[model samples]
Target chain A: MTKQLRPLMIGVVGDSAAGKTTLTRGIAQILGGDATVVCLDDYHRYDRKERKELGITALSPECNYIDIMEQHVNLLRLGQPILKPVYNHSTGTLDRPEYVAPGKLVIVEGLLSLHTPALQRCFDVTIYLDPDERLRRRWKVARDTHKRGYKPEEVLAAIERRMPDSERYIWPQKKAADLIVRFWPPYGYFDENVDNRHLNVRIFQRHTLPRPDLTAVLDHSHNGRRDAISLEKDVWSGGQPVDILDIDGTISREKAAELEQVIWEQLHFSDQLHPELLGAFSEGARERHSDPLALTQLLIVYYLLTVRKHRPVEIT
Target chain B: MTKQLRPLMIGVVGDSAAGKTTLTRGIAQILGGDATVVCLDDYHRYDRKERKELGITALSPECNYIDIMEQHVNLLRLGQPILKPVYNHSTGTLDRPEYVAPGKLVIVEGLLSLHTPALQRCFDVTIYLDPDERLRRRWKVARDTHKRGYKPEEVLAAIERRMPDSERYIWPQKKAADLIVRFWPPYGYFDENVDNRHLNVRIFQRHTLPRPDLTAVLDHSHNGRRDAISLEKDVWSGGQPVDILDIDGTISREKAAELEQVIWEQLHFSDQLHPELLGAFSEGARERHSDPLALTQLLIVYYLLTVRKHRPVEIT
Candidate 1:
């Protein structure tokens, strides 16, 4: 039986609270059994306590082992297993290392995955999450305080201190990314107190990787759902020409479903992969679905599952 | 600057408490900054508590991430860095991972280092520690109770439970080793109260790699010490044709020094590397020197440093 020669790798890079985990989870869930999610944060050179003592931010290149990260990612890209460390986010300590094997698609999610060219070459598809600063701070405070055992003030302070490293190491990686995904509050559409579930998503598709064409479907599918979906060719950050796809937070369910079908069909395995797992987010105990998140997730998975013709992922 | 294409690797494998660490430490200490020591135990899939819950022995391949180990070893062989996991033996937990860069010589030490051909190929030289079972048991009991936080009875029980795995997974790996090092109490010469530092060492030189010629020195160096050093061609375990070099624990200080000088000359650049680190071992908290161990360690370092001529390891 013939296989894909090597496992497909996708790198999802972003700052903390940039919804990278949420986006990667949706893609993995949508891809079903074909994806393995690896967090690059596990390769931190220093623990949280050690970082504080050393007076270094985790976002700095010096604070992480980029060389080891490159080797491990290359190994996974070649369909080899790696002893991946487990960083206990809640306890802020590195726990036991886990044996991680590559699936047909390896989804590497982290802050500095695209920081190095060596790391960038390992990924078949790359994404950079660029959530607006205000929304990211809000998300960080909520997630860190509730799930990561941090006080809201500590979370805010960390974000404040991480700015220099974020610009030096993180923001520049967007140039290496195939897609730059941004979620932001639509100024007049919602007040400053807008909840996360209603944020609009704009996907900047670069020429680095071939992305799905949604303009034809967009022209016919909206069906009176105002500003629900649109495809526009524009110059993004750093004057890079990119094809942008926007999914409005106020999009109606029926219109969102139609756009989802177009992107899902573009991925070419609608009958094989289920759609129920897409776009599900949690707020404490409450689970909610966002149309914008679902479309963004489906678009990202489109890049993953559609890169090559089907050879039966089961064989790989 | 021209240098060796790859870093030289040495694998020292054995069952628990087989003197792998002691041998590797001496080699690294003798080689000074040119060596990096990696313990295979850090690739364990289950921690001490989890191993107990699962009722699986660490000696078994199932308890360790051998695939990950193979990949990481390959990376180091290419003069690469690895995010190596640090297993805390005292706490019986896997703690923070360490970022380990390959030095000129990487001394990989632990059980199952030579368990597979993939791992075996990574080593330029391989040594297996096969201390006599009784001596090994004594060493394990002493070590586990004092350093590893276990009772003597518990250590004995663990050794008993690990026997099947040791036979199945550990013993067979000796065939892949270039040198089989055995430390034991000489039956007729020593009583049951013989200490660890006084144990005799038998070096089983396999024909896998070109070994140093110690026969010329051994022919005349014995002078007055009975069985102080001897080279004998014999069939070792499983009818393997082996050249055995035996170092008696009771060698005279002058004779041991002469043999050490012979082996030291064979290694080249005796002026470059200091000879003080070879024979040091701790009996409880007291530092002691052993003639047999010093010779055995010098012999291993001879294989490592003499494998290739002076290409200036500093370039690597």
Candidate 2:
């Protein structure tokens, strides 16, 4: 007569090219193969031609079955399997629905994962990537032109055209997030020629959940003054306060290792988390690297594990 | 036909009990005796009793002569005099309008100084006080119950009643500010027994104005981690990035003095800005204090002096 326990749900919501996929991939790698990633982008009701003909961008909620997504999220939260719709990104067409079973961890990531309150409430942790607009546009251009076989001008035009819908749909969901991850060029280092490796990341820890206490690991002596990394208490617009943890792109390998050790020790997992798997991202045999990306993934993993440790015995 | 030099205008706007007067008084004290402060609260068309009778709060635009205030601000920016309305807080009645001439520095502090684009454009610098709601309510309750002769219940009722109007009118003006000053209880120090001197202050330097370069004086080594004072680059909710300068309440006198000296040296004023005068505020001969408040005042003074030094030769 006992109810079955559900998988731990994490939601990652952001605009196109806001690094949602990379973030999800990193966290999944850290959690090992037991994690399942569900791309809500697969729920797109229209193909590229249909969207173009209708003059509607993929960012618009009207273009997606939001209610179905919400229902699926609720079902997944109850440890149930669902036939999820699939949309092919490279082919720009709808694919057949696939049966997706709940795993130990379910990471739902896409433009509208947090658009509805019901969907938002389903996740134990929700993250929104909010990289600088200029940086995001550059990422989009690089991604669409190189991988998606789109001309540079077409990608730029699509981005510009999607701005209104992005503002209305994707951006507002940022407020609902438990954590907001923003990647930008470091202060005084913003230049047209800056590399992605040189971009700093800021993680805004909203007061919605119990955040990991980094006091033991944080070098208080080098507090807000250090260029490598810092954590600060801040207030958001509308007066909602948050804690901002900033990681510089120039963080030394030694510093990164030290930080990783602190977080790993705190997690107290019986199976030690592999350090190398934390920030690993690859593209066609080429490895892309970022220390900030690793730390962010580790932080999300910490939250997931904390939820698992604290789950009610009855549910288990 | 010689053109006259205009007064340097600074606007301070916030909701009631958001500490507008204290901020203005400190800045005026630092600027010496010649500075003139104009209370835009004086421009209220309806007296306290009248507002209550009409079921209108003081926060609403309709209850105040915003047009007259805006016109007067324009005149003051041009060093012109105006017969400004006076709302006597002690009597809850409107007195005869008084003729006021602009000094070298004209500080306009009240609820709606930055409400209109016309009014906002008149100031060399515009500041908005955005104290925490809980802390601000505590301040309001204390002030209304003591100075304004309102019952505790009455004050609480008034705050609740004014919420809709405050939202409609007062909060919207925050977006127009060049700097936002937020005073709050530090994280984990929100006990009822905590003293006001122990509160933290955060200054959001918006992208509206070219902020003073404090890199030479700021201890960047301490970054966002110092127990006393720290400065950080941060992003606002709507994705407009800002530099957040945080001042801890427990900042040592020595640390405060050292910071003050660094700022003063950078100003290079022929008439040395007095350290004691910088952050001075009084309550019935009992001198109340805060190091963060002093530093904030000094920063404003630096901005004012910078504008003065850079004014066109024709205007001078």
Candidate 3:
């Protein structure tokens, strides 16, 4: 925050249950207390019951105070404070607003972070979670039931209801993203598979923003099989050429740590950050780690830090 | 708004019972639907009960979220909306927050509008209300007892407790004001006099910002006695020389209307605004209008519109 620098802003946008929170939580853990993670649910224009009565899905820009969202992000970029609105998830009501002052890093994660050009201008780098549709549905059901107290059938119904708005207002933002993160289950795996933790992670680094050089680690890493962490040229779903870093879910933590080491060297702040704190997920009451997820977070961090090297505080 | 102009910002600041709300309301009414009057109590960090238990008065910057106030003002100046905190004065509790989008004129009235350099930068023009201490004390007792459910002695005690902070944090802001407005009863009148409405109004034009050319009307007008509306140059208590516009409350509505006509001619928007709507005040359930108040509001509008003439759409 010193040295006359505006906080680095990173946007994480995705459809519901696309692992946005998990990714954001890991990034926050790595960035530690200096990162202020803003969840966009706080901008909801209608509480749950109101939305149901109005028959408006939350994914619609009309269902949130999008203008206020733009204003809050712009204020955060100026290193100013904001009295942010809060939308309660468990109770499906609007909670008391909270005052948040921007820290060294501002990570805005939500369903429609890139819904408008004004919002897009606030970020130094943007990541869009485009997880496999089936896997996302499963995650949504699991999350709603476990955390939000929604029945599985109700969660499914909500997903179905949200599909149109999600497609219209949320998915198109992937084209505007600097990086696209997609997690997918392995072949022949069903939704209830216990090995769902082994879902493979793929990160598409578009040329819109700078990214870490993972090709070096992939070609020569002293860990598991070279294929465990690999980079391949690919055409993005958005019709752009991109470099996709593939992290196998079967990859060992040692392999993931080795990959992270490369990014840590680029970051130059590894000692202050604990790599072990990354990729933390919960299995019922117990906690588990996903190496693929850990590597994905490391790549995102590396990309975030790269922005500093490319442009140091040209923020208005 | 369609012309891509940033809203005009006029800051009205004063200590408790200096008539900030009355002045602000008159200005808002004159500006019609295009004015947004933001009361400063929304930024109170502690509710009334909390301030009592903590033995902290609201005049201290520490007792309020001054930084958030600065942030919200800056946002409003940018014509962006804010989820503003609401401190319920009647109940002395923090109520539900409200979303406020700026209209053409954003009139911020508060106890500490000019308290900080950042807050000072948000205004196009700033006003400080500086009624005589005894008169102000009477106003405070009356308002608290009538509107906030406080007994007369209890209100007086609270005022006594707040005096130190008021002197420390509130009064000094007068130095930053563009216009210093003071309302005082005529000679020999006590607090309970029915002729309190005949108080003289003095507005000190500090030349910190552009003001309407009021001297033209004072020197020659079509109504009242020669000295009913007069201008005098005086040395400010802060040591600066200022031109004070004095308005005799005893001046008839015809005299006030003549003065308002001069400002209206300068404003060029008289066709859309009704002078009759100005100076509205509530005495119990009855509405009353003070000619002195009406003339004051007209002068404020004249100063506000003059800003557009001096610097148009240069807001950053």
Candidate 4:
């Protein structure tokens, strides 16, 4: 009998606190309740004490079971299930392996998702979160110090220790990305009072994959003018040619909806999908925010859905 | 009295045989009879014999009256008329000066159009033609050998002699362009049997100016496909970030017309302009070919008109 068609796989790779989980969460929400999510960090072979004794950070490939990760990726691509390992961040220890069944859509996110050529080939689409170093450091310190019970000094020290490994292994993976997303402050506008809501984002849509065209929605007069969103073509950075979509953190609710409307109109198959699920970030049990984040999530969802539609029909 | 508002100035700069004249001619046709066209080659102080005797090529700044060119550009910017010198290519000699008055639009085309900051600052828009070296050399040899009474070997020798000057003076002006246009053969299909009609063009829309949004009309899947046209984002060349719009030379007439119609609809004010006047190349008397050339010309016209719309109205 012919093999059954497997699930669509998307890989999200980035440095720690580079917003991989946030991006994956937004994508999962858009794909509805059925999409399965996995983290490659779960493949870690050493606990915190073991890593400390070995003098290697979790960012190093040597600290993880790369072979097992590759095997699991291959299995998932073939519609087979795997017992996935778990690394508990809070307790800094390894938990029991949990059973994971491939679903219609599978999102694999972690630092080393694109590390191996075999693993990279398993992804239908790949994204790399490349936020500014300063912002990423801030996010890491805040998360570790508050939620993970690590002191501020300890978090800073960990980041410093991981820098070498990140540069050697994690950063090079950016070259393999179909999209490189960076979040930072808008040019000439910087304030200490700014929060995540006030941060601007630059999404670099690479030629590795077909990108959603934003030319119709791009406002040419918006360059250097104050606009919540803008599209720039042919921006050169470090000798790489990239098209940039700039979304201001201060984008208004009305403008955000209008932008979403434009994107939604292009997604003819997404009518059944709830529009409200996009661009959402929750704080505790009560508060949620949406603006530029919603727009960013909407673009990603658009790309994923487009890839699905273009996939060749399989025979069983 | 306050100086009268000048006509819109557009500078088209490129190296020798880079299709600057063809592009300028198309724009002139689209703009109708009122646009004043000036060739900066008129500013050449030395004739062909003089340049040869001086052991210098016309590409050198020292070979041209740059001070006079700057003064004329300044005068044109203020809506004043100038007695512009004429360099007669047919006879390889300087001709009588002609009176030139600024009209609704002024197009200045030549090698040094953007060579000086003062001249560069006078234009509302600038375009740089950067065709492939092999294609440009072919165009140069064909044009000179056929029309200018030069032998094939003579044309090639002239090109070789001018290489250093072209590199030192002409190519550097590409960095100042708001748009860099390159027409070449599509990857992998190379044959001497192909003509100009089979050349593909990549237009790089830089972030330096506000670019018209073409997202709604962009066909992303056309990148590697056999589509007649496509737009790609985040294409890196020599490590620079750029958005590319590729127009296949083999694009069918129907497809070209359809693409032109889409662009024309966006140009709401061009109702009086005849669309047929675009993308024409002269051979003898009446033979004309239309394909991707027409579509490329339409986009440039669209951009020029858009810039005119945003220009602030002057009170009489």
Candidate 5:
């Protein structure tokens, strides 16, 4: 018997508040099996205490970029057979070292991946995200103060210190990118008078190298899943409507069982899903709950097959 | 007479340890009249003292990036600038603010400028400095330990803390760069085996953009000016070698006066000694220097022109 290894590497780069992590997770979910996400923010040369005592901001190149870039690139280039530094974002310190072996796909998202030439060369494909400044700032303001425990003033000062270095070193990498994704907040969600806008995933290399349209792929994968709805127009009173399967007593057990089988057949399968699919469906159901509609659809399908009960989605 | 206005906005981005100020001053010297250099570093929401107390790394976006970015971008975009933050890299604090109007070129360099899409769009051109990791680390260790009053462990720690943020937010911008510059240490002189390697400028840019070729431009501009050579390539080393032109000597007063005419004729148009032109030459010379080249070049240039009774480069 021969063991075949398929190695995959993905690089995501964007501004501080540009939703690189959110974007990374979306991709990981789409390609879900076993996924490990590593963020480069954990490798700061100084701790919060050290930065305060020394009246220095971490904007200059004098920070610990060399080690971070070196370690990340080395591991990535070596096919992910390594231990990576894990810093707790909440505490702003290093945590346990995590081991990441070569897998189907490895997604690395950070600011400086492309900053160093050696590191930039390690990626199979590179993505740079450009989001609206106002939206990003709002997101950053919220994330920093609420999630990261930073004061508004503190966040601002650090941004100032970092501006010059960022402009000089980082923004120029956009030209080298395979794709530049620009994100705007959902249009017309703010007010009825406002125009509804769609987020654009601009493929710069469209003429050169085109990947399958992510939205199309998502649509196909999500189609007939019993609960998913294509987000079209925003209703002020409520969000997008979802389909709920009614399990009725009038339906026979055999018909109900057949309905479950049909729903399961429509769902996408990962390589790791077991041959006996019920257990996999349960685990997948938990994840789909993160998106309400996904969970609702699965629940509706399960009701139709297991219990002949005609009931609407329970609000709770 | 009509007032000519060609708004110049210069954007500079580099990694935390990359040499930004050293590069900024290179352009400042050329445009010396009423020139102001503004650092976005001072706008950091947290001063060095506060960040250490909070025990949070200053480089993370959780700190004050939104305000700094908004203010800096607003000022530059509006052409109604402020006293930009003054972050003393040697002493980490916001000591004073200096007013900067839009110059022939307004150079803004820092880490997060590229991270912020709005800020990135504001720049006409962008640059990324790709320095050797080993060299940058050495610089960091030395600067953080000696000047910034950070212990080796502290410096290393701070760098580690900021690594993820830098990678996630900082490094990706390198792919969007208009110009990517990699510096190499100058080669050995006559003795090939003798490694007289000192840092030298090695610029890299895309074929689509106009290359910033400072050497060729300076060479042509240096004509008729005094020439000085370094004995050991210590650019700041004085008493190296100087060439002085002789047209006026100890002769009759009238004859000596005629020699001034001869000297002026040889160098035609005394108006050519405009401070702006000389300033450009000095700026170019300063950039070409490695460690002490600028200091040494000034010493040599000053000695030959003033003390040695040779042709002086006058400012009109």
Candidate 6:
């Protein structure tokens, strides 16, 4: 079994407006050619019209992905292959079959990604995105009108209907993460001009402490009580909650340098000339603190820290 | 809006393993005289194997119920109704051209009953069942073996695979409910001889708070916040956690003599001859609660509680 050990798994979770996909894409860029991105949205249980007939609105956790998460995690753990579902954000439709193979880093990203314990067990690291409510709303408006073909009013209505399920399933997942990234305006915060077109990204939580090897942590079989629910328990991570930096989104480019320096120094690995990573961070350099690139860097660090600290114990 | 009031809406929710249909049958026995029980399980997005091939599960909140819930709720809310999809639990198949009109009470029950807020908002009450895990397992085992023609090992494996989704989608629902009834035993509490034949009799969660008038609740238009989650929150019911009760398989023919008197005093109605109210507290008394009376009574009370609380806000 030791002959073919896998690298690790990581999860990025958030609501639709929470910028989970963007955050994941940027992280994948930083991880370079070695990482693979798997979106959980493809597992939706129904299409639009069917969902309408059923009298439901929005993609609540219960509406879909829960079971898919289970299956995907199993496939990932076994290092077996799977034909991942492909989804279209622009059309709000799922595409034909697609598959994914293991890579140096397997990043699972989507709504409710960390919601299940079994799925969570598959992750070496976990990250949550908590964007400013207003910014997120604005993003939704733009995305819905332009991409989803929904009017502003329709989008607003859709959002309202989703709140109950979000509270019931999505938001609570934040409490279980190794890192919680909150996007906020930097110094003289909120002074930055609002750009309805560009959504600002921020890293609210960056775990500075050394992360344990998650594989080792999850290796121990769960002999624990099945129904035991503990708010303070480490869950799959099996350690204290990691302390992380909560960065502001409105910081100046110079401030971004400082943030980047801190992150690089912590890893003790000098940043290399990976054009993709550099490009991702620089694309929104003006607001590097909040751009997708900076957010990605924060997430990558979170994943590395977790993998390094917690090692899954080998079981017979 | 005031001129077009609709019937009260009630939703029944439980996990696949939980005896939702059996519980629904009990409620139907009591309210069937004047109300209609609609089975939402019929609108499954896909069958068992189809769902598995797609790497999804039936319990997903994102199942095809969105459209079904929307259509059904609209009809009931608008004072116009139609037939609902009927799922044959025995055959594990769906039958079309089946629906229930809006009667005095519209009792909608199924796996994702409370999954969607839009659907949930249309209901006057919402109920969830949380039976003993072992009982659920055994019931599923038997059903799969005899009904679905699966071996015990296969059922066990299926159950194992489904747990993640169950925890993510179903268990969290218990917290959202107003009443949570846990069944346990020293055995002699409700009946001297515990009967394992039908685990269906257990009542796990019952929401008993009085609800607003159905029409009045549905009259209020709901427009969710922009960029909010796909989950609904406006119609949430607030109350303490559920209280657990121990009831054996056998119900006593005896009533706490004072219990009847207490119920009469609370209701302030002296109608012993009224069969409906008589069954509320008397063992083997209410025509609906007879034979399997105790279990039926448990379900009726649960059904009543939900209707009272959710009062529909407005018809679409």
The positional error of residue B86 in candidate 2, measured at the CA in angstroms, is 76
Superposed by TM-score, candidate 6 places the C-alpha of residue A185 at a distance from the truth, in angstroms, of 2.9
Of the pair 1 and 5, which is ahead by TM-score?
1
Q: Could you give the CAPRI-style class of model 5?
A: incorrect
Q: Whole-model lDDT for model 4 versus the true structure?
A: 0.76
Model 2: runs farther than 4 Å from truth? Answer: A1-4, A220-227, A270-275, A282-285, A310-316, B1-316
C-alpha positional error of residue A29 in candidate 3 after TM-score superposition, expressed in Å? 1.8
The i-RMS of every model, in angstroms, reads: 1.2, 33.0, 1.8, 38.9, 17.2, 13.7
lDDT per residue for candidate 4 within A125-234, as digits (tens), equals 89999997887877788777667778989998988877889899999998888788888866665555446765788888766666766654554214244676776768
Candidate 4 residue-wise lDDT at B202: 90
Please tell me which model should have the higher TM-score, number 2 or number 5: 2
Off by over 4 Å in 5: A1-3, A52-60, A153-157, A186-203, A206-316, B1-316
Clashing residue pairs, backbone N/CA/C < 3 A, model 3: none
Error of 5 at A223 (Å): 16
Can you write out model 6's per-residue Cα lDDT over A65-112, one digit (the tens) per residue?
A: 465467656566556545455555565565443446767567888777
- Winner on TM-score between 2 and 6 is 2
DockQ of each: 0.64, 0.00, 0.57, 0.00, 0.01, 0.01
- Best-fitting candidate, scored by DockQ: 1
Highest TM-score against the true fold, candidate = 3
Tens digits of per-residue lDDT, candidate 2, B65-156, equal: 77667767876787766556677889877754454778877999998889999999899889999999988888888778767788878988
Q: Stretches of candidate 6 above 4 Å error?
A: A1-4, A89-94, A186-192, A195-244, A248-250, A258-262, A265-275, A278-296, A302-306, A309-316, B1-316
Write candidate 3's Cα lDDT for A1-316 as tens digits: 3456788899989999888888888888776668899988689888889999998887778889998899889888878777888887777877657778888889999988998999999999999999889888888887878877889999999888878888899889998898888888776775466475688878888888766666666764544444776778888565788987777777776666777776677685767875656888875567888878877888778777778778887544
Worst 10 residues of 2 chain B by lDDT: B220-229
TM-score of predicted chain A against the true chain A, for each candidate? 0.91, 0.92, 0.92, 0.90, 0.59, 0.73
TM-score: model 3 vs. ground truth: 0.92
Runs of candidate 3 exceeding 4 Å displacement: A220-226, A236-239, A262-266, A314-316, B1-3, B49-53, B220-226, B237-239, B313-316
